[model samples]
Target: MSRLTERLHRMLHADDRLDREMAAEWEEAPAGKPASLPPEEVNPDTPAEQPDWWISVPFRQGRGLRRLLVVLSVLLCVGIITVLVITAQYLPHFGQAGNPANNEVSRRYIENGMEETGAVNIVAGMILDYRAFDTLGESNVLFTAVCAVMLLLRVSADKRRSAAYQLELETDDRMYEPKNDLILRSIARLLIPCILLLGMYIILNGHLSPGGGFSGGAVMGAGLILMLNAYGFRRMERFFTIRLFRAVTVCALSFYALSKAYSFFTGANHLPSVITPGTPGMIFSAGLIPYLNISVGLVVCCTIYSLYTLFRKGDL
Candidate 1:
């Protein structure tokens, strides 16, 4: 019995020693940071040392691109600046001293449309009949911008959290939610509808007056933004689905393109339209011109609203 006990004791002691040696080895291993470091020692790895001059130098070198580009850019800028300066200098003389392009376009739209299409508004005539293609291009641009903005929005919180743990990334700030204010919200609610209605009116009247589709659409979009701030994202989502906006955009662009192609192919470009560009000064009618302006206004308003929603909400 005594001999058996002695053997057992030796086995236990050996196991204990092995455990202790392993623990010591682990503690002494050359790994991560020590408990302390000398204050005088500096960390060599820092963002400040990694100079970004390589990236910056490329931009500097780009300044010496083909002379043609420089000349063209300068000429373009000068032309625009010259127009703005001259406009600022003599806007009062706009009607008295007319530009050939402006006069020709205006005269063709107002005079010819009434004579041919019987449209009352010159601006409407220009957009709907003469420049539908341009409106379509502009609408596509807005749609593209909306998509890009949405794509850049931050990922979901769960995704962000997963990334932080897996890749050691810091948390990104979430979009802000405004504090509740009953009074402000009420005011917004009251004002938003009026603003939207006004925009619609502007769009509708574009053929008859100074305002056009772009202006009207932009105004309505602003109203939508205001409503989002005042009410909430959910409400906006419920009311204005992206699908609806996409449908409207596609339809408008399609109609514009197809109509323009038809007009061009059929050589109806100068042919008289069904609608009379009513007497030059009348507010009652403009031919297809007013309709085109309304379409553009709708497209612009939808685009602006869609963009605002994408940035603010981040979810598709």
Candidate 2:
């Protein structure tokens, strides 16, 4: 029994000594080297660490191209500035008394414009009658700019959040809400009708008064903006929808184009026109000028409103 007990003690001491030697060896191993794990524990499918994106081949190429483009753009701008400076230095001074603008063309327009266009406002006569083609080009430019903006910024309905969801989100966002001040609402309510009436008076009397289509249209647009600010977009949308905007804009442009075309054809051929230029200084005097003013007003009003709506919420 004593010999059996002694053998058991010897076995226990041998196991302890083996464990101590293994732990010492593990502690002494360099951290730079991985521990010698069992073959079955190794993972062969694990991926290696990748370098940063900035050091990749495609990224380096793109960076080089971007730098080249920036340099080229700078050079182009400098060249254009130099050319414009040289050209301007050789040109006539501002508002010179003897400039060609003070010539016979101006005299004829100033003296006979009322008789020719029946518009007491000479500036209105000049823009809508004498240089109607230029006004047409300007309107077309505005339309083109609007289309370009829509193309770039308008998102597809499929990609966008549902209208109901979007509306709820926007309603929660207090930034879009109208002020609830009683004084402001009262003032707006009182002034909005007067503003709209005044705008209409300006537009209708454009041929006789100092105000023309552009100015009257601007005032009308301001009135609309005021209404939106006071009452909010949902209320504004009740009367002015995207469909109404499209229809008005298209019809106004078409009418202006066809009317101007007929006028231009008759004048160029020196043919007597059936339409008579009414009595000067009268509200309904200008032959086609009043109609032109209405058309221009419609175009301008729609443009202003559309721009506001589109920029605010990326839609109209």
Highest-TM-score candidate: 2
User: For model 2, what is the C-alpha lDDT against the true structure?
Assistant: 0.76
Off by over 4 Å in 2: 1-102, 162-181
TM-score of each: 0.56, 0.65
In the range 1-316, model 2's lDDT, one tens digit per residue, is 9976775564435435444555676677786664552233234353221211112222333444767998999999999999999998987777999876678998899999999899999988999999988887877777777677777666446435454435544566556465766777889999989988888888899899888767777788888888877887788889898788778888988999999899888989999886578999988788999998988887787777777777766667
User: Number of the top candidate by lDDT?
Assistant: 2
Global lDDT for candidate 1?
Answer: 0.66
**Please, what are the lDDT tens digits per residue for candidate 1 over residues 25-117?**
667766763433223223456534223222222233333364568799999999999999988986454555555445576666655765555
Backbone clashes for every candidate come to 16, 0
Clashes of 2: 0
